[model samples]
Target: MADAGYVLPDEELAQLQKLSSDFEPETTGPLVGERQSSAAITTEYANADPVYRVKTAALPSKYAYFRTCRGDGHCGWRAIAFTYLEALVREANVGKFEEEEARLMSINNLFNNVGINYELIIDFAEEMFDLLHKLAHSVSSNDGNADAILLQAFNDMGTSLSIITYIKFLASAWVQAHPADFEAFITTGDVKTYCSLSIEPSQCELDYVAVGALSAALIKPAGFAFEIMYLDRSAGEEVNATVFSQPTDQNGMLLPNPPTIRLLYRPGHYDILYKAEDFPPPVQQQPIQVALANPYNDSFIPSESSVDIMAMIPGMYSTSFGHRWPSVPYEFDASPTPQAQVTPVQPYTPTPASAAPVNTSRQDYMPVHASHQPNHSNTGRHGLHLEGPPVTLPIHSLPPPPVSIERGHLTLERGGPFRPSMYELEQINVPSFQTSIFKNSQYNTAHYMNPDFQPEAWSPDTEYGAGHKGKHKPPAQ
Candidate 1:
């Protein structure tokens, strides 16, 4: 007979007890979350108590960013482990990682001094060393993925657990070896006994004594500073800071702005923290200019290459040649067969005509217009006669006065394999040919059709001379 309240039957009570025992609190997020702005912390406590709101609001001003660690029992250890490798990564010094591995190996003596068996801790120790080697390789090669490697390594439960266990062993060994320092803090009055129960146990979270021991044994010797900022519902407007180590030189003087490992501690859990200056801003890569291979024709020479080659040949380009041919517009007759005819003109030939044919023949790949024949010409040296209106070749300068020398006695000397042309002899006292047939023809010195083309030069003195008179004076007045 039960009392006033109804009592459950024995089978029902057993089932309820089993259900309660089997229940576990649901946990979410990655093992170690991505680094993000610390402002999120302020937003998370926006509707919370006034003390939390004030503290979190001020957090981002000093510490620009933070990274979360899952709040399992191992968060504190995992956070410190993650941040240690991270600080090494930020340094980006391969030699330092090797030195750290060596230093850690040397501390195996500490484990031996405390009577800890090597066999028991070798698997855990190997994981830490392998990670060190991997990070060192990444930093040395400048793969630009060292941070991602570190994040992934810590996120892996097996690797993360092994690393945490290794550090735990180190903390325990350091405490036991330094009994005099930690003996007073241990309530059990035995250093080894306290470490066995508190530090070495797989289930126990990292305690204050272990943090101090790890700071002494691992971090301070490596020239890195470690800090933990406590965030809690205390009376202060901001979280409190506790520095475990400060790097110093051989003289015990503090080093200036050495790399620091900072952790944000909120009661039982820990996360990583960073100031704005922890890393340099990403650099934008400049585009590289590549020289593409010319694919149109192998025999065709580039303009620049031609200029360079011509410069090397003597007299190919000469100062004696007064003016260079200005780039003139071509307005030649397009008529293929013009019925218009004048007296049968004799063909003008150059002593260098043989080489010209070879050069022109190789340039067959060039676009050829029917009106402008680069390969061969049949009508005359000046060009063919057509019925179109006269096209004036714009003359920028006056031509040099021709000396009335004998055509037979004239001898033009040029460099290389080229010889003189008979038509190139100066045509002295020849009347100006302004006919429709000769306009824009090769006869013009400014035209590219002439091999030794030179622009005509203007003489202001001759044009405005006091003694100068026009060809047709005004009625002999």
Candidate 2:
């Protein structure tokens, strides 16, 4: 170490300062991060220079979101690669993924023409193709998980490096193919030599020439526009954008409003940019309407002990049938086993005029406990003879509870939702026997107006046990 008192010469001091300025620390964080509101960019520059503060302040008004790319030397290439796949995902078309894979496969010939060895790039190309396959499956399955899958694949160091290398080679091959278009930008003038030394190297950052090549070779043909917004000390209130490619039709007519892959370019780093219009509105899930099968046939007769046949005959009884209850199928997640959907039971009002008839005999409609008996005082209504007090239906006559047999090994816990039974909903227009003591009482299940009304029953076992309690021994003897 140099002594504190020692003074360095001007030439040596200049060399040391240059080395220090050129050195960059190793990058950290995910290669690509989650998409976040671009207001974060403005906040990041709150204490920064006036130019940066002014530019970033106007950023969120136009670009609603920004995603970070790691500041490693390959960020430019990584940004473009990631955004290209993301744009395809935004398209939400399974066919587009296949089309892109085939187009990239054909580009192998370009590599061959440019003297890039097939074996050298095959491993990297395979990684790229594998991601394409996974994304295609996600779209076709309607999993709505392409965003998560794409983010994870890019975060994997091995997969990310392989894909970055693959694109670097692609850019190199594209540049070599069209010398006239890019030769002027190449300082070395020799296209082959420039690509070998700079464009195709694994550690080199992406440059203007390579970005243009990628735009033409990969993005434009995939029906996407390519743009880069330069945020710098440049004289502007907003960041300046340069459009490298705009998708066009076969007739060379410009296509309007194509999916775009935008990048926010700093002096030596690159991140992704997006407008509010980039994302489609979230799909509002309508309740899953399960169309029930046909009504029971005449041959299928109800047992003698079932609810009076008059109640089953629509318009004969004044009972109001509730709405068609929506039963939601379990929502399958990214995991192999579908996580159970725990939908809250919504109270449905029974529409009298247009509502279809629902089977009241289904177990979900049956009352569990027997306490309150059915009303039987109608004199001439519905052409029924007034019978003695309604009797309790026998337990054997009740249908079995509906069985929900899940396909996989998912063990449903008690927290899982169940449809609210007919007896569980509010009983409207029914006579209320509310006294001051019984008002809002949980123990009022016996009341006819109770939401959980149950028909009263006499149990033979309880009666015999109570009457013969003390005489049992003498009887046995």
lDDT of 1 by residue, 225-260 (tens): 999998998766567889999989999999899888
Per-candidate RMSD, Å: 32.1, 23.7
Worst 10 residues of 2 by lDDT: 285-294
Q: Provide the global lDDT of candidate 2 against the true structure.
A: 0.58
Query: 1-477, model 2: which lDDT tens digit per residue?
Result: 576456456557889999997888766766888675564565455445656755775576567668888888889999999999999888999999999999999999999998989788999999999999999999999998998999999989899999999999999999999998999998874999999988888779999999989999989999999999999999865799999989999999899999999999989989999976787534221110010001111211223333333245343233232111101101111222111211123111122321211111111222211211222211211112112212332211111111111100011111112233222232231222111112111112221112221111211123222321221111110
TM-score per prediction, in order, is 0.55, 0.56
TM-score of predicted structure 2:
0.56
- The best candidate by lDDT is 2
